[model samples]
Target: MVDRPNKPSAIAPAASAPQPTVDIADDNSSITATLPSGENVTVLLHGATVTSWKSGPGAEKKENLWVSEKAVLDGSKPVRGGIPLVFPIFGAPPANHATSKLPQHGFARNLRWEYLGKSTSESTTSGDAGTGPTDNSVKLDFGLYSANLTDEQQDQWPYDFGLVYSVTLSRDTLQTMLNVRNEGQLGFDFQMLLHTYFRIGDIGSTAITGLSGVTYTDKVLNATEHAQAENAVRIAGETDRVYKRIPQSTTSIVEGDKPRFDVVRDNLPDTVVWNPFKEKAAAMADFAPDGDYVHMVCVEAGYVSDWVRLEPGDTWEGGQRLRSLL
Candidate 1:
């Protein structure tokens, strides 16, 4: 004798738009971005560093960036691979380090960044890059301010500054832009580099093109300057060379007859190509395992070998974009 409803329950509401998937979880230490164009990238808040980038379909889907299997994900130390930012100092301590107490590569890679929410191509006008595939792009901004630093951190580098690092994903193309602004009263000089670790199916057969006419300083052989003699730069053993005064050009990393990726830089004048090889690879604990260095290569964009002098209230900008080839 109970009355029963004949109509089914209301259907679920439909979403207004097909938003690209993104997740900020694990206590907000990392972000996973899944683009609509079959691309996925992961960003770590600690260094605002991009640890992984993968694209393509089916068997073509391969990781373009290399991160060590045992990389420290807890932010305790710099991750072994991916793109590590070397800012305010590229190598050893600079002669004019602000408080002269900063670490080897400065504090940019070790400290956490402030995520300034998502940015779209429609909202922004320009970046350090002059051209890009901006339509339907997913952009994220990470910031670091010296004022927010602890007293001890300030003691290491006293100059006030702000860094807005932006990573934009447009389909299969990835762009990273670094914008540094001086907030102090006087000018400061510094060196910087974007150490990019690229993944390879086999490193022994790979050769990089576009450094033939360029001049480089070999780091392994007494830091001597040498004119590149080969059309294709090949790695024999523990290759480490820093090309200086590089012209605006595109460099391609090839596996066999086909290219793996194209590295394009803007305002970055130096290029560093390094691989620890077998002997040195086994000697380091951070590199991990017995022979992991062969699967990765570092083709960095830099402004070192010469210092960059930034005036107060001025900004210094540079960046590099990587696009994987199918």
Candidate 2:
């Protein structure tokens, strides 16, 4: 018989490691979720805006979202940067439309939201034998309803609707999902968008891919329509084009041949690329250090090309997933 090494005593399973955490601010202003790997995301209760998202650990860590230095985070006005939620209307309300009396970009980004707690899960990449390293993710949910709106806001575009906005953060990705439910006896029409601002090394060195051959309406040029001629769009001047009916679901922001971010959307067919450039950037009081506009860009995903009519007792859902390649 082969001499087996003296059987070692059975080892007790290691104590469960400390899991990720969700922390609420003492003043009930923001909620932050941090993973064991040091990646973190913070969402302000005001507007349910995602104001910060940092990836990596220690020296390799970087802030992927941009918030203006002069942004009014004290709930005075809408935060100037980060991912600000837009609903009911995209820009100025159209004449004689159901949302005509609503303010620009609607009231979603200007009101406070209630935190609806969090959920945690683990995801794994496919590998040999369908096994791979596990990544822990945390999702935070927020809610807003017609009852939560101000009296003046209700008078503008009254509709009994419930909005559930979920923000999910993992090791390498950040996903935001929105569910709109009609809670009243009457149906209403609205628009929705995730106005995401991404930080970049330099604006001139960056290019956006996946919009080639797509038709767009240039809001800066008196709403003229044009077809994209280049596969990769380089922002040379002020860009405020609404690209409708995107052929693909994925759009990438590349800087000097390296992919910085991949934005994937579901049930969102419109993309808005906007940069205030120099003149307009200086005109906005909230933009701050106007030159900083070169350090960021807004690649928004939404259903703004047309209004979505939500009938009574029905629900509509849409979302966008952002993967950081840096």
The C-alpha stretches of model 2 lying farther than 4 A from their native spots are 1-11, 57-59, 124-132
Give per-model TM-scores: 0.87, 0.94
Tens-digit lDDT track for model 1 on 1-326? 86677867889985443346778977999887776556777889988889988876664557889888778978899888999888878777755556257788778888888888776442223564434323356788889999767798887777889999988876667888899999999788778888899988778889988788889989899889999888799886999999988775578899988988888987888889999999998877788655878888899988887888889999988888888887
Q: Clash pairs of candidate 1? A: none
Give the lowest summed-lDDT range of ten residues in model 2.
Answer: 124-133
Query: lDDT scores for all predictions?
Result: 0.82, 0.92
Quality of model 2 by C-alpha lDDT: 0.92
